[model samples]
Target: MLSVLTLNVQAAALPRARRLLAWLDARDDNLIILTETSNGPGTAYLLEQCRAAGLDVTHTPSPDGDRGCAIVSRLPTTARPDLLAGVTLPGRAVAVTVNTESAITVLGLYVPSSDRAPAKVAKKRAFLTSVIDGLRGLTEGQRAHLIVGGDYNVISRNHRPRYPGFLSFEYEFLDALEQLDLADAHQRLHPTTQAHSWIGRGGNGYRFDYLHTGAALTPHLASCDYLHQPRDRQLSDHAAVAATLRLTVDHRTAVSAPLAEAAALS
Candidate 1:
């Protein structure tokens, strides 16, 4: 089984970094994706600490030097340069192919937050549309597994926002994701479960962070859950989400030592 974790480490402050490092050191996940990082000295130091903790990490700093995304894996990972594009607003997205039981392309994303301004709304919609198109292109000639997780900042019919968080265009774009065969990992596991990953204004809770895996990998999915302890303890505003998958050995061509161990552990 391969365990993947996703979290938004809020601006990557020093205190948050300390908490994150300690927490990460205690867990033995195969891969971890982080969002909302900055290019500031604090975030850089945190990334260094992650590497020192024995993780192979890759990061993309935002254009303005904040709100970036990162991917860290115990298994060897190669950044997919083709996945880098202008889809993301100012902050960039990062995608890496993990050499594990199977070659799984894991994407770390931080979608643009909703705003009152029309320009900002348009930007968000365009980014979401581009993301769907890119995913379609990436999986065209490949049989590799796909895992996308991060802060989507959108809502579905069953999941209502505190206020007017997600617009019609945003919802439509998410609906388009189904055409790419992506399924919400948590919802697939527990269709009736209601959970929140982040708290918005007036204490309105929302599940902005999610792990969406390719439908082809559904049979291999073991579990997907949210670890809210960090947010509850004020470690970060967003809770950490984790997904476990049992990959078939036949699909794997390149297996790293760490990934092999992870499979053995499962």
Candidate 2:
């Protein structure tokens, strides 16, 4: 069984980072994807713990250093490619291919919220389009086990900005994932349940985090859902999403330096 967890750790909150490491140490999740890491000493310490726990780690730092994404795996991981084809805000996304009993391409993303100026909105749209195009290209040629999960900053529906989320374009961009045959694992397993990962002011909630898997991986999906304990406990504002799959391969492969810098941390 391969367990994968994705979370936005909320800007390197030290206490939460420690708690996250401790929780991860207790589990056997093969892959963990984190966003909004903030490139701080706390995250560095957590990386140390992941290394001690025998997990390979790779990270993409945002230019400003306030946010970033990381991929940690117990199995070997090689850098895949950034989903963006053009210029994009750094540290918001990272991709890696994990080779174990089976090879799975995983992407951790933190899509920008479009509640900003026109330029920022354009950038966000472009980033979303680039990711879609990248996945489309992957599916058109070599089909690999693919899973992309993280804070999308968009909801499942296209309702007006009633609370806090994108309205139209973002919703359509997300719908493209489904068009490409990627199933929203959480929704697939828990159809009709209005589970929210992020709570807003006045007790409103939004399901901004998600895990979308390729069609080929659907059958192997043992489970996919949110872990709200940390969020409820105030360890982090976003709930961690977890997915489990049964794979049957076991080997390592080399990856490009740009995809992965350091060797698996021991």
Candidate 3:
């Protein structure tokens, strides 16, 4: 099975990064997407350690004070930065084509969060628009085998409790993805279940993270669920989401040797 996990790291510092690295070392997910990353020592350390453990890591560091995303894969992958060239914040979106039985292009995104401020709202809206344009630019074949996962910061139209303050454009982003033929993996598997990835200070819950699969790959989605251990353990404020696909990667090409070796050295 092809296992994929996505988590919002909350722009961790060096200390938290170490803890995050240790936690990641204990997991065997084939692919991991880290959101809310920064171009700082913390993200650097985490990516470096991932590489040291023989994983294929891809990240486009955000500008000095910006936040971004990263992708760490055990299966071989080729970076596809060109796919999101039109993105307003290129670093916030990282794309890669994983070399599995059927090539799957994975796009990890860290959509900008906005408040009532006009500038921030405009920025967020523009970024969301650029994201749609970027996806629209992809070829039909690419869209068929794509997986988009990230911390969207926007709840669905039917979100329970219906938190106030979200703009219409934010909701349109999800609608646009659906129009492009991508389906929410978690929602597909548990249509009646209510799960939260991030909790607000007021004790409210929000499903801010998601994994959406292309039409062709949606049928192969074996399972998709949220893992709250990370949040409960304080590794991150947001729960991690994992999805399993009925697919296989070349075992010989997958990275397990270095992780095993690192464990032995320790």
Candidate 4:
């Protein structure tokens, strides 16, 4: 069993930040991600906090907005070309390969919000399209286990938005995920125990965080949850989403055969 957690930590108060870090410390979640990270000082501060706690931080920012995204992973991670190339998206973006007890690859992501201005919105679309294309190169996690996670911002049938009017964006997003054939990680589990990552200040709430997986990975999903119980007033207006999955493959099977084969031939 391997666990991954995603949150938009709001980057507000030191106390609130500490609370999040403390929560992570308590859990055995192999990977942690935060979206809408404060660009400079606050990001550095949070990075330090994670570092002191023994998490290695990898950060990235968008060209159009003050907000950014970060990956805090305990498991060994290597940069993926899709994320390392640094495509021209508006907000912060990050992608990493998490080597866990069960799986070798987990995509650590933070996509741009569609709520930003017109140009930023356009940039967000570009980012989404790029991600879709990048996902195509990935091997389906049937005999293998792979995961794509982050603040997806748009939810599909597996999830929905807090505000009803926000469905327009979600509709498009659902279509995209459907087109990609990515299954909602939470749906395979008991829906009653399911939770999402958002709590509306207006009292509206929705499940916006996600773990998109392929058909083979769909069944391995054992549990999904949204940690909505707030420690403070508003922690970046988004809660954390966590999951546990029972993978079918052993760690040895997860090794990249292509790379190994190439080395053998050489």
Candidate 5:
């Protein structure tokens, strides 16, 4: 089976990155998507460790002071940078085609978080719009093999406790994903269940992280659930989401870049 997990590293520093790497190394996931990454020592160390462990790593460092995403896979993968070339924050989204039993294109995303400030609002809106446009550009077959997941930074309209201050555009992004045939993997399995990946100082919970599977792939989604160990252990402020697919991976070919080269890029 294909086991996939997504977590926001919170741009961890060197110390926390080492601990996070240890935790990740203990998991048996085939694919892992890490969001809120940076071109810092912490991210570099994490990527290097993954490479040393013989896992393929794909990452495009975010510009200085920016955050991005990375993909770590036990199976061979080809980077698909063209997929999100037009995104406002290109580094925040990375796509790779995994050479599994049935080739799947996994896109890792780190949507910008925003407050009431006009500039931040515009930034978030633009990125969300570009993501929608990018997905729309995919052909029917491509969409069918896609799995997009990460920190969305926006709660769904039906989210319980209904925190206020979210603008229309934020909600529209989620709507657009569904319109594009990407079903919320977690919600599909637990329609009436309530879960949160992040919590605020006031103790309010928000479901800001998600995993959306394309229409064709949704049927193979065996299970999707949130794990709070990362958060509970203070590894990160956000919980990790894990999903298991009935699909299998081809173990014949496992590719990974050299540690030196991977470290240089990170």
Candidate 6:
């Protein structure tokens, strides 16, 4: 089974992001995704922390700072930018392919929340389109398993009423998601989890972070949930979302199971 934990640690400063590390430390997942880390803290620090907590880690930074993304894991994975599709956006999402004996590929994506401006909004929309197109290559029960996790910065109507500018933007994002036949693991698997990642300057909080996988991934979907226990109004204001996927043991399951059953019959 391959389980992945994804979080946007706001800034990777130790004191500021210690809870983020602690939260990850508790989970024994196969993979971990951390987005929005500051360049000052660097990928080395996050990798070191993951090693201390006993996970093999690797990270790829976006050409732009703060747009950097990282992937840490107990599972053996090779990080590559070639696997990602180009959207001409400021930041980039790291595509980490876990070379399991299963031959499965899991791409981790972090889409940014462009602020309110015509240009920025247009960029966000274009980026979303590219991401969907990039991931559309996957075919069910075969090829690769695409698991995209990131701070989308769009709030869902199911969680809270639409924020002022979010009305059109959020709908567009969701529509793009549906168009690609991908499922938001949080909403589909666990709807009760609190809206996480942002406490707006306005009165309400937001659930901008997500773990989205194609319907082809349904079999491996184990469980999904959020940690909203201690709502820190000041300390970065984004809660973490975690997901567990019970992956098969590649072809070994199908091949060995039948043989084993045959042996039992004999």
Please write out the lDDT profile of model 2 over residues 1-266, one tens digit for every residue: 67889888887666667777666555556788887777787787777666655568888666676466788887788886544444365467788887765567888888886666897788778878777777777743233478888888888673323554355778787789888878888888888777688887777778888888887787788898888986877768989899988776453432212111121232
lDDT of 5 by residue, 59-120 (tens): 98866669999999988899999998899998899999998877899999999999789999
Q: Rate the local accuracy (lDDT) of all candidates.
A: 0.75, 0.73, 0.90, 0.61, 0.89, 0.61
State, as a TM-score between 0 and 1, how close model 1 is to the true structure.
0.87
CA shift of 94, model 5, Å: 0.4
The lDDT, on a scale of 0 to 1, for candidate 1 is 0.75
Question: For model 6, what is the error of residue 186's alpha carbon versus the real structure, in angstroms, after optimal superposition?
Answer: 2.0
Report clash pairs, candidate 1: none
Clashing residue pairs in candidate 6 (N, C-alpha, C atoms within 3 angstroms): 102-250, 197-238, 197-239
Q: Per-residue CA lDDT of candidate 4, range 103-190, in tens?
A: 4555655666665567867766776666665666555552145566777777655444435545355457657665566666775565
Provide the lDDT at 62 for model 4: 51
Candidate with more favorable, higher TM-score: 4 or 6? 6
In terms of TM-score, which candidate is stronger, 3 or 6? Answer: 3
* 1 or 3, greater by lDDT: 3
The TM-score measured for candidate 3 stands at 0.96
**Model 5, position 79: C-alpha lDDT score:** 96
Off by over 4 Å in 5: 254-266
Cα deviation of 234 in candidate 6 (Å)? 6.8
Candidate 3 lDDT tens digits, 2-104 = 9999999999998888787777777788999999998888888888777878899999886667999999999899999889889999889999999999889
Runs in model 4 with CA error above 4 Å?
A: 61-65, 83-86, 101-103, 139-144, 157-170, 191-196, 231-233, 247-266
TM-score winner between candidates 1 and 3: 3
Question: In TM-score terms, which candidate is top?
Answer: 3
Measured with C-alpha atoms, the lDDT of residue 124 in candidate 3 is: 91
The C-alpha RMSD in Å for every predicted model, in order, reads: 5.0, 5.1, 1.6, 8.6, 3.2, 9.0
Q: How many clashing residue pairs appear in each of the predictions shown? A: 0, 2, 0, 1, 0, 3
